[model samples]
Target: MLRHVVLFTWSDDADEERREQTLAALRRLPEEVGGMTSFAVGPDAGLREGNAHTALVADFPDVEAWRRYADDPVHLQIIADHVKPILAARSAVQYEV
Candidate 1:
């Protein structure tokens, strides 16, 4: 299995509405897009310096699955329609286990 990890930091002005929208979009991906074996998203309790405010943990069969997810039209729409507005910064890391 492979883990696709994503972290996001929101600006001070980004409010609950944005979070909710982001969550809704996030929650929809596994059902709407193919190739995602698993998915999770939530706030970070770690609070490490520069640690992302929100995190997504996804498990896919392989890197190709990851690419499918990354390129899915619905996913792309979420990035353009919602995430891009409220997202201050984001980071992603992928690895196999």
Candidate 2:
């Protein structure tokens, strides 16, 4: 299996409602996009600065499936619409399991 991980920071003006919506959008990814075996997210509670506010973990059967999901149109749209507005810094990592 392969794991896809993402960590994101919100803009300074981002609020609770928007964050919730962002989480909802994220939670819907596995159902909307194919090749996702599982997904999980959590709020970042560390008090340190320069920390991401949220993180996402996705499990895929293989690299090809991961690529298909990454490039899916609906997922792309969500990234452009709902995600970009609230996101500041972002980082991702993918690896075999």
Candidate 3:
């Protein structure tokens, strides 16, 4: 399987309502798109200083599945409409699991 992890830092203007909207949209990805075996996303736990504001973890069966998820229109829309506007920085990795 392939595990995809993404960390996001939001802009200072990202308020509670916008953050919640982004989270709500992201939480719908598995249902709205295909090839995601499992998915989880949420704000950081505040356990450490300088952590990313949010994290997303998803599992897929293979590279092709991951690619489909990456290219899915719903996912793209969510990024465009919800994430990009508030995003300041992002880091991501995909690895075998």
Candidate 4:
């Protein structure tokens, strides 16, 4: 399987409502897009200082499935509509699990 992981840092002005909105939008992706074996996303636990604001992990059957998820219109729309406005930085990786 392939595991996709992403970390996001929010802009300084990001508020709870905006963050919640982004998370809620992301939570809908698995239903909207296909080929995901598993998916999870959430805000940081605050157990460590300087951690990214949020993280997402998704599992797919193969690179093709991951690619489909990457290019999915629903995912793109969520990023454009909910994430970009408040996003300060992002890091992501995909690897065999």
Q: Per-prediction TM-score, please?
A: 0.87, 0.91, 0.97, 0.97
Distance from true location, Cα of 48 in model 3, Å: 0.6
| Per-residue lDDT over 1-97 for candidate 4, one digit per residue giving the tens place of the 0 to 100 score | 9999999999989889989999999889899886899999999999999999999999999999999999988889999999999999999999999
Residue-level lDDT of model 1, residues 13-79, one tens digit each, is 9888878888788778888886877788887787577677888999999998899889989899988
Candidate 2 clashing pairs, residues 3+ apart or interchain: none
Query: Compared to the true structure, candidate 2 yields what TM-score?
Result: 0.91
lDDT of 1: 0.85
RMSD, one per candidate, in order:
1.8, 1.4, 0.7, 0.7
Inter-residue clash pairs, candidate 4:
none
Residue range 1-97, candidate 3, lDDT tens digits? 9999999999999999999999999998988986888899999999999999999999999999999999988899999999999999999999999
Residue pairs with backbone atoms closer than 3 Å in model 1 (clashes): none
Which model scores highest in lDDT? 3
Looking at model 4, residue 40 earns an lDDT score of 96
Q: Residue 84 error for model 3, in Å?
A: 0.4
lDDT (tens digit, per residue) of candidate 2 on 1-97:
9999999998989899999888888888878886888889778888888788999999999999999999999999989887899888999999999
* Candidate 2 lDDT for residue 93: 97
Q: Least accurate stretch of 10 residues (summed lDDT) in model 4? A: 26-35
lDDT value, residue 29 of candidate 1: 82
Could you tell me how far off, in angstroms, the CA of residue 74 lies in candidate 3 after the best superposition?
A: 1.1
Give lDDT per model, in order: 0.85, 0.89, 0.94, 0.93
Which model, 1 or 3, shows the larger lDDT?
Answer: 3
